[model samples]
Target: MTIAAIIVNYGTGKLILDHLIQIREELATVPGSHLYIVDNLSPNGDAALLTEGTTGMDDVTVIGAPRNGGFSYGNNRGFDQAIADGGYDHYYLLNPDAYPRPGCLKALLAFMAEHPKAGLVGSRLEGLDGHIQSSAFRFMSLESEFASAAKLGIFNRLFASKRVARPPQDEAHKTDWVCGASMLLTAEALEKVGLMDEKYFLYFEEVDFQRAIIKAGFEIWYVPSAHAIHLVGQSTDMKDGKQSAGTAPDYWYDSRRYYFEKNHGAAFADKADRAWAWGKRAGGLKSLLKGQGLSSVDRDIAGLEAARKRAAS
Candidate 1:
C-alpha cells in the first residue's frame, strides 16, 4: 500500500535532519512511500535549512507555509500537496523529533488492513530513556476537568472512570483519541471527517478531529506494536513538563476554551470551566493549609475568566 509521511517543522529542522535516516528506513518497509515536511515559516530559518537539506532527495518534499499557521495548518498544507500528487492510501502524521522503530510503518499498516473500521491508529510513544508516555486519552468532561486540576489522590480515585489519561497499553485497543505526534490516518477517514479545525493554533486540534471521526462512525486505536521514540516538547518548550495553572500562554487558554465550546456548546463549556476553577481553588487551599505554599498549583480563575470574556465578545 502507498503511504505519505508528514512532518511539521516549527523550529526543529535539526531534529528532522537527525532522524531522517530512521524515518527513511521505516518508510522503506512500505515500498513507494513518500515523506513531506511542512515548515511553518519558522523565524529561526527552519524553512531554508529544511529545503537545502532535502535538496536532491527524490522521496522527500519540503513545503513552506505562507505564515506560521500552527500544527494543523502545516499538516493540511502537506495533505493538500499529497492529494495533488495522488495515489496514497494512508497519511502518517509524524513529529520532527519522533523516530519510528524498524517495522513501525508496516505494523501500523497491517493493523489498518485487518481492521477496516479503524480510521485512525497511533503508535506507542516512548522517551529516549525508554519510558512510556501518555498516548491515548478519553474525551474531556466535567469530572475529568475537576480531577485533572484537583490532582488529589482521592478525587483521582473517585473520578478514575472519567480521567482523560489512559494507562499505557501492551496491545492495540480502541480509544477516544491518541496523540497527534505519531498517528496513521486513512484517507477514507480524512475524506469523511474533513481536515482538522485550523482554529486551534497548537493544542486540542487532534482531540477535536478525533471526536469528529468517532461522531462520523469511525474507530480510533492505539497500537503498541508500532513504536516511536518521541522527544516530547522539543518543538514547543511550553509543553516540556508539568505546567502550573494559569501560567500557560494566552493561545493555550484560547485553544482550550475553543475546544470545549466547539465540542460541547457554550453552556457545557461554562460548566466545565467552573468545575475546573473550583477544583484548582480547592487544591490551592489545601496546599496553603498544609504550609506547602502555592508554588505548584496556582488557580487559573482569572485567566479562564478572561478567556470566557473573549469568547463571549
Candidate 2:
C-alpha cells in the first residue's frame, strides 16, 4: 500500500462514518491507499455502527479496540497493524472530526516526495466558519503556554477573531510541530522516531513525536495547499461541563511537563514548567476569588504543584 489513513475514533461514530465515506469518494483516485479505523471503545456503543457503516467500502477496515487507549495508543495500534500487513509507505493520522478536502492526501504526499528530509506533513486546517486554525505551531514552551493561557499569543486570535490572519496559503513551510488532526508521516520516519509516546493520554504527544523526528535528522513541514475542515473541540463539547478536580487539568499539566522533561531533562523542565503552571494557577484563582466562575481554578493550580513535587522527588 502507498498510504494507510489511520483514524482513531473515540465516541465520534457518526463523524467517523462520514469521514470514511468522504475518504473513499475523494481519495479513491490515489493508488494503493486504504482507510483504517480504530474505534477507541466509545461509551455510546457506536463502534459497531462505524464498523457496519463502512463494511461495504472496498478500502475501509474497522478494528474495535477492547479499551480506550487514548489518542496516541489508539493510533499506534492502527500503525502497528498496518506495518504488520506490509507494503504501506506512509501513514496518515487523521482525527474523526476532521474532513479532508479533495486532493489533500495527494498534495501532502507530493510535498513529502519532493522533500526527502520531511518526516511529517500537515495540511491547513479551517473550522466550520472558514477561519484558519493554527494547524502548525512552534513547540509549546513556558512562554508559549503563558501566552496561550493568558490569551495573549498568536493562538489567541485563533479563538477570538472570526477570521484570523495567516501566512500566505501557497507556500510549504517548515514548522516545529503540526496538529495531529490531519498529519501524514512517512513509514521511514516512524521507523526512526518509533511511535507516538503513549504517556500522553490526549494532548502534547504530537509535540513529543515531532521533536523526536527533528532530533533524528528529519524535518516537519506544513503544506498550506492541502486543506481539511476540523470541527474543533466537538468531543470535548459533548462532555459534562464540570471539570474533574484531580485529573482534568492534571492530565494536561502532566503531559506538558512530561514532554519537556523527557526531551530537555528533569531540572530544566521542572523550573520552567512549574513556574508557568503556578502562574496560570494564580491567575485562575484570582479569577475565581473575584466572584467569577467556579473555584476549579484552585484545583488546577494544586494539581500542577503536586505534579511538580512528584517530579522533584
Candidate 3:
C-alpha cells in the first residue's frame, strides 16, 4: 500500500524535525510512503530552518504555507499535494509532537487492507510514561459535553456511552472519531468526504471530519495494537499533566463554538450552551446535596459562560 504522512508544524522547533526523523526510521522498510512537514507560517525563523534542514532526507519535503492558517489549513495543503501527485492510497496525519513505535505505520496499513470499509483508523496513543492518552472518542453532544465539563461521577456513569473520550479497549472496535495526533485515512474515504474542514482553527476538526466520513457510509475504528507516543500537548502547550488543562486559549473557545454551530446549527448550539449551564448547576447541586464535595465544582463558570456566549454569537 502507498501511504503519505503529513505533519503540521507551528513554532515547535526540533520537535517537528525529530518527529520526521523518527517517522523515517520507523518506515525505513515500508515502501511507497512519502513524508511532508508543513510549516504553518510560524512567526519565528523555525520555518526556514525546518525547510532547510529536512529537505535533503529521502522522500521528505517541507511546505511553506503563505498564511498561518491553523492545523486544518496546513494538513489540507499537504493532502492537496498528495492527491495531485497520485499513487498514494492513504494519508497519515501525524502530529509533530507524536512519535510512532516500530511497525506503527505497517500495522495501520495492514488494518486498512483487512477492513475495506474502514474510513479512518487511529493508533492507541501512549504518553511518554506509557499511560494511554484519550485517543479514540465519541462525537460531541449536549449531554456528553455537560458530563465531561461538569466532571461529576454520576454524570460520567450515566453518560458513559455518549462520553467523548473512550478508554482503549483490549480489542479493536469502532468509534465515532479518533484524535488527529496519529490518524490514518484511506484515499477513497478522504476523496468521498473531502478534506479536513478548515473552519476549526485548532480543535474539533477531526470530529467534524469524521462526522462527514461516517455520513458518507464509512466506519471509524480504534486499533490498540498500533501504537504511538504522544508527548501530550508538546505542539500546542494546551495540556500540563494527566488530568489538568492549562487555561484554554481564545482560539480553543472559538473552535469549540464553531464545531457546535457548524454541525448542529446555530439554534441547537444555543441549546448546547444552555444545556451546559444547566448541567453544571445540576451537578453542583447534586454534589452539595450528597455532601460529597462543595457547593460548586464548576469553578470555571465564568469561562464557560464566555465560551458559550462566543458560540452563541
Q: How many residue pairs collide in each prediction?
A: 0, 0, 0
Which is the better candidate, 1 or 3, if ranked by lDDT? 1
TM-score of predicted structure 1: 0.95
In terms of lDDT, the poorest run of 10 residues in model 1 is 237-246
Q: Write the per-residue lDDT of candidate 3 for residues 79-138, one digit (tens) a residue.
A: 987777774888889999997888888888888889989999999999878898878888
lDDT-wise, the better of 1 and 2 is 1
**Cα lDDT listed for each candidate:** 0.88, 0.76, 0.81
Q: After the best TM-score superposition of candidate 1, give how far the Cα of residue 212 lies from its true spot, in angstroms.
A: 1.0
**TM-score for predicted model 3 compared with the true structure:** 0.89
Looking at model 3, residue 95 earns an lDDT score of 92
Name the lDDT value of residue 58 in candidate 1: 89
lDDT of 1 by residue, 1-313 (tens): 8899999998899989999989988888888999999999989999999999888988999998999998889999999999999848999999887889888888999999999999999999999899999899999889999878787898999999999989998989999999988999999999998788898898888999999999989999999999999998777765622343327666677788999999889999999899988888777888888888775455367778888899899
Task: Assess candidate 1 and give its lDDT.
Answer: 0.88
Taking all chains together, the TM-score of candidate 2 against the true structure is 0.86
Number of the top TM-score candidate: 1
Q: Model 2 lDDT vs. the true structure?
A: 0.76
The predictions' CA RMSDs to the true structure, in order, are 1.9, 4.4, 3.2
**Model 3 spans > 4 angstroms off:** 240-246, 281-313
